[model samples]
Target: MGVGVRVGVFLPAAGFPGMDHGEVLAAAVEAAVAAERAGFDDVWIAEHHFMSYGMCPSAVTLAGYVLGRTERVTVGTAVSVLSTCHPVALAEQAALLDRVSGGRFRLGVGRGGPWVDLEVFGTGLDRYENGFEESLDVLLAALGRERVSAEGERFRFREVAMVPRPARPMLPVVAATSAGTVRLAAARGLPMLLGMHVGDAEKAAMVEEYTAAAGDLGGPEVAHVAAGVAYVADTTREAVAVMEETLPRWLGPGLSGYRPVDGRPYVPKDPVEYAGLLCRLHPVGSPGHCADTMLTTIERTGVRHLILLVEGAGDPALTIRNIARLGAEVLPKVRASA
Candidate 1:
């Protein structure tokens, strides 16, 4: 048996039509708490606002709530959009969450995926990359150092100090992909969280790329977390059939960036075609199959931390059942054999 890997749950609290907002959020909370009870190591919440896909507008807020509710597992924002707010304010919120959580808070910041929120927030599209980079610089300085200073294309500040500094080490960056983003993370001496959309082959290559990038930057070894959909059922046939039925609907506009072969976004086309493509990127099968897939993923990606981004179908009951199965069947086996 190899050393076990860290597994975390990515909370997807939806605000679908006809569903009360409170109920959706409550369901997500219950699921997260169950995952912790299932012996998961962390719970991650993604930031999305005014969207039916994900009702949660504030990952930090939800993270704090989760931390307060749970005792052991770390709670973190899968990513908080960096360009959406001032660096100091984001830093304070993160640091305060850490303190409140008794150092069980992990933060992941990103430039954010596509949405109309940029215009809504009045952050123009032009110079977005520059602005995001600048924001990250300022954010890292504030979290890691007592005094923060920055002069950049989007922001300019001088020797500002964060009043409530982080109690633990500053949180690592999540949702960092692309060679450019990996290089940035390496330069900052932080780990990168690879997206769930990535396939095993791509994940392995990315690990290599990140390692080389860190070496070139004369930085420390760069740790990384791999993420993807995971499910375990009584039979492989049942699991695959279930995923094919539920996942296409689950893959909405939010996941348009998860390009399959031909390097194009997966449009809703032939159901069979789309499902096949999604399967290439996800793991869904019997317990033994899921365990084998996870083991192969770890071997290929060299990532010790694995985040199960999707559980059961949209059905709440199925979601909870899958979590239980993962904990009871797959998790123990993986730990013993990893």
Candidate 2:
């Protein structure tokens, strides 16, 4: 049997200091194209609003652009925050992209933080806290059927047709951080996008929970996606040095930009410590080390797909090189082992 392993790149459109918004966006697009050139299977775009951490407020829109720029690789939204967006509207956009991209677009949705975006978008904190489930239900309904309507707590709308209906039913990838979200995805027969900061054991447990929940719903076989950092070099020390040098500069200001709408204290991580931790947890080393690390993660979590955050070097050229090196050097060993 063939090894069912897929590797993709995550482009955060990170708004690091010293680079303008245009530069950041251009870099993200460049990385996506390079990912395809490097033989990766997909490119996942991240969404954030009013934060230096990520400048892409509209991940679906960006996915469309990336789809236009690349031919073979699938382009997905790492997550379009569902709370601040109308589910139907996002679903329509996803459908449109799917048609235009020839079924290459995947919509990944998440419950964003209680940030000021809720107020700016007029979605309110209740939407962030209690409305995610309702929004997800509406999104799923809109994607699955041609004609749909919602009479839910947060949304009440008459039946409407999904114009330019999707050619194929699109199953969204849910970003799961806790049991509640994991169960939510599992019950819906959806795949979870596990986060980067989590360890293999934690991810394995979440997978177990999801499998158990899915078993109750007839045990459909699912392939979850694990997100992690990726950087490579001739030696482990060289790779670690590059990440330590570049990641902290971007992680600091980018992380500090979050503002809680409810006046809650929001403390960003210590960039230095967090970068070091990520280097340890992720595939940041020589080719052998990188492969071994990813193999362990795949084995422990039973996740067949991996979406790696590849901009740790904080430079467009270096990030592209990292993607290429990973595709050329690290992925072969990983594929062989799996």
Candidate 3:
């Protein structure tokens, strides 16, 4: 089989300095176009509600907008938190987007963030996993046009037919999960989008568990394992500098109410510490080094698809250049080695 690495740009609304909302959107759209031109196979957008970090709260809407601009690139939701929205609404929106994109839409779902987001939605954190499971069942049944009637603890859906079915019968549905949710994805035979932002050891354990569970489920296609990381500049020093400058603002006191580890916030206080953490989690280095890192990661984890989180670096232009560099210098070598 031919090897493919799907590179995506994560669009965050919170601009670095000297950039506003309109500027950020414009820059992100430009970057998406650049990614397409640079030969990246697919692009995925994220969903977050009431967070300055994620501008696109509605991923399907943004994917529709991006679909209008690009011809060949596959657009998808990196992880639409299923617990927050009604399954029928999400199904209808995804179906419409799939039609608009001529079947270039992929669906990625997750249980969502911890307590803070749950509070915003008036949902208890304890119900996150249950809500996700119920929502997924509703969504899949709706998409398949199955007469769904369920009276679960979290959701109750009567016999209903969701209109505007997706153009493709079997649209790829990926489960975005960490260690806690990996087994669920495997047991259900869903492809996994592994979060690489969590440390390297965690990522490795997650991959290992996912692979073993997938094997138990009859060895289905090894189900695409895509890992993501915030890729930065040409050198280790520049990468650390970028991380140092952006981490505090990105994970500032706005999130103070959330529970911290040992009274320290979930985010790191020192830039160097954060940078070291990111370096372990992400493949941040020169293009050649990054390529080698990706290859090694693929060999170790057997992940077929890779999503590089380039927008975290705080410079749109630099992010675009890195995309080009990765497409030109990184992907080819990786493919050749494969």
lDDT of each: 0.74, 0.91, 0.67
Task: Give the root-mean-square deviation of each candidate in angstroms.
Answer: 3.9, 1.3, 3.4
Per-candidate clashes, comma-separated: 1, 0, 0
- Judged by TM-score, which candidate is best? 2
Which tens-of-lDDT digit does each residue in 204-266 have in candidate 1? Answer: 787677777677643234557777777778988888888877766645543442223223344
Instruction: Name the best candidate (by lDDT).
Output: 2
- Residue 209, model 2: Cα distance from true site in angstroms: 0.9
| Model 2, position 151: C-alpha lDDT score | 83
The TM-scores, one per candidate, come to 0.89, 0.98, 0.85
Q: Candidate 2 lDDT, tens digit per residue, 258-328?
A: 89999999898999999999999999999999999999998888888999999888888899899999989
Off by over 4 Å in 3: 12-14, 122-126, 170-180, 199-201, 215-220, 230-234, 253-272
What digit string (tens of lDDT, one per residue) describes model 3 on residues 1-338? 14454455555443554557677676777777777888877778777665456666777777788888999988888777776777777888888888878988878777775645665666666557456766677777777774556687877767776668887764345555555567766766777777655644555677678778777662536546455555546786676666666655554532332442123247524544554676666667666667777777776666667776667666677778767777776777767775
Ranking of models by lDDT: 2, 1, 3
